[model samples]
Target: MSTEQPQSGDPTGMAGPVTDDARLFPPLQGRAVPVAQDRWERLVSAVDIPQPPEAVWAALTDPGRVAHWFGVCRGNWARADCEVMLDFEDGEFFWCRIQQNSAPTADHPGRLRYLWRWVGIGPVTSVTWTVAASEGGTSVTVVEEAVNPPSDWRSWNGMGWPGILDQLAAHLRTGTTWRWPWRRMGPYLQVPLPAPPFQAWEALTAPGAVRHWLQPCAGSLAVDDEMTVVMGDASGCALLKVTRLVDSGQEFPSYLPYLEFELRRPRWPAPLAGRIWIEPVGLHESLLQVFQSGWEGVGIPAAVVERRILTGYWTSAAARAQMLLRPPGAQAPPIGPHGWSLSGGDDG
Candidate 1:
């Protein structure tokens, strides 16, 4: 199902702050509490699907059907200790070994358990899919637990399950699955700078200096302030809300100074977040790192093209900034995802 909302005003326009009222999914529910004295952490979420247990069981076990909603399952569930490979078409294939596959009986529900791990990776985790008869049809629950949880485990994985379950519910009710393999598109670039870290930081944060490399931008880029970035010839503009402006000489002197902003556009599915920071290399050299995430906007083919254009713009922008800082007669660096180039691209 399409999640894109209708656009108003210019397609490349300003955006409002993201609020709970604009969220597409329900309030996230789940826990990341440690189990067994901090040895392992669990993420769990449940949804009541308006379908029979038998249908839900087939969707969970059938390889072809599972591929429709989740990843491509390539093994027989009926076989004892079956080894399965779940390929989500994202360059990585997850290897799973079935630990339990109890079919639904007259008195009880069904439970599918497996040991999940990346190929050649250690510390495999456990994943369980349960389906039971509920008031209307079936209640499906998913649990995944692993050791050494990351710092954002609660907000990332724990809250993410509800959205996946929502997708599952949509698939069962209307036979419509979202765009397959919703790839995450976060482009990262690092450019070697001829100047020191402070100079490079000024080229990034100073609105007047930024005009030479990127589009003409005018606004106080302080924390909690907003900046207006004008497109070519002032065709359109976008707003960037400065979320952070960390200085190296601040209280946290050990931390690298960085500027983080929330990019807003009228037609975007969600606001994208980006950051620019300086890394000192030597007495007179530094590296400028630019990274932006939240590119998967749920509109597959169009989103893919949009992402490439956006990435190209950022890449070219960094290249321009590097050129502005480079000394005359300096040879150009290699052209790659991380290198500098002067080719221009449009941005929203």
Candidate 2:
């Protein structure tokens, strides 16, 4: 991964030793994190494939060849105004409508444009793929732009860009594919709390209790209520409505006393949903589990939902509640998304 300078007459920006801009643009170290900007954020990565742009373009737009490097692409790119679904190796899926397919010719590079979205009906976020002939190879770039960027835009695409472009490079070089690994690790938490299930429910549904750990509370949380949760680190928010509240343990299936929520945001085409189920295990103790479902929906971007933020927001909130339920001067356990600890007096 040594950096090289661009040679004279080189159209491919891939030639030079990558500069600081490479981290954001492309040809970056695989581990570099995406940097954020006001109103928008950019993630750029480039690779020098020893083939011409035409070959790269074929691999990119060809449905059969795409799954080799990217995800499983469905639909006919050759068909005008075709709709495509990119089911990623990680089980995340994207719905895309082709707007322009500027095929590559011997005299000109190829340009393909699409209206990409999390669901069949959400924001028309732009995703453009460009391929150009370079000094010794082809230069390819994947650009995604959200006009009204979601709060977790950086988390959704920024952190995962390098690996994506890397897979494309490997595909060109050795025909390799990628499988998303977080499916087994995301948005799931099991932490025993020192407080009873009722007390934990109060913190979760109380008007402003979520603000302490998750985000600033907006609106109310009555059963069948609708509210907004704002991000503390960014200006984005998720709009949600509590659709059901089951409080009868006797009649409730599996010790029922759970809550269901349907999430939405203006401009997004699909719905996101979540649930929380509580189970008591001991006197003044409870087993708290937070389940963030509805990811199977195309409306919510996999990047936005398949994270600790959506998955762990409540887990972290549960941690905060554990702190609140304990007496003053009690210490907080060093629990994590996958860590486990009993609900008891401070062991420290």
Candidate 3:
């Protein structure tokens, strides 16, 4: 899903650091909390592992070890400004630039800082990882910070860290890694629209137009409106509640409108929270940024099943929306022969 051109050298990037002995650490619980101060909001999560600092540091910097817990990381982090790519298998891939990578010193713990961006959509944020010695082992902490984040920013980014850190602990302890069940820890997707902002926004929010692409809705898309969504199969009712609404010119004229909503279905353990921002690329073009996260409390297998069903639903909806927005006889850019699925979907 990364649109950037390939780098010039080292197509595979550098191999991960290796050590002769891979130590096993006993697992312990981790914690995550959202911090808001001044203009910035940050997610902080930490976990303690019963392993030495050197072993934990190796697991943190080594791509091979990282993949066991996090994702497939491709980059040379020996210096600053290195282009880093982390692909979280299901179509969730991210490209960032490392701002700093500092090894542990006698006086301080090891730290890494990177500017996280997803190929031109959504706000850029900073992610920092720290490794320090704990009472009996090592403590690893991850912090992600952004200025003026979305309404559900904390849940979108914070919900998955405890699980992620648990996986990390499992990796260091068992030498085997299980797939992380949750998928909505960050921005879900961003796609270009062939129409202007007005057209795209109308197609996304207007009840009549929305029915052509998304499911049928019983009420308007106004703030605090609790609408009942008619599912394709009509098995049960789906509920949608609008939480926040911001038009482009009302606050930030140059920016597109932002909408936040909470969706609930009969079978879901928790409501799915979503945020949409329609950015005007030009007078006749726009970009849609979508963020979603929630309802993964049901372990790995059940979560995977839910994700598969939702993937198909969202893919078909997006394709229909694109068709509705396209100008007559004008071909939009080729998405794919199989249809445009979300980057994290199996079809994608």
Model 3, residue pairs in steric clash: 90-344, 91-343
> For residues 1-348, what per-residue lDDT tens digits would candidate 2 score against the true structure?
867655777766654555665767864458665343235555555667788887888888788777766667766653458877775533234667888888777677778888765423223477777788888989887777764444345675755367777777778788755544434332434445566677776765565555554444575556666677653234356777778877736543465477777766555676666766666654566655555554555354545543433433443455565566666677656655422222221111
**C-alpha local distance difference test of each model:** 0.65, 0.59, 0.66
Q: Please list the residue runs of candidate 1 whose C-alpha ends up more than 4 Å from where it truly belongs after superposition.
A: 1-39, 77-80, 118-123, 158-160, 177-181, 186-348
Local accuracy of candidate 1 as per-residue lDDT tens digits, 192-254: 677777777766666665655665456667788776764322235557778988886664655
What is the TM-score of each predicted model, taking all chains together?
Answer: 0.45, 0.44, 0.50
Rank all candidate structures by their lDDT, best first, as comma-separated numbers: 3, 1, 2
lDDT of 3: 0.66
Model 3, 260-326: lDDT tens per residue?
9887776776778887677655346666666667645423445554454454455455555666676
Q: Which 10 consecutive residues of model 3 have the lowest summed lDDT?
A: 14-23
The stretch of ten residues in a row with the least summed lDDT in candidate 2 is: 339-348
1 versus 3: better TM-score goes to? 3
Give lDDT for model 2: 0.59
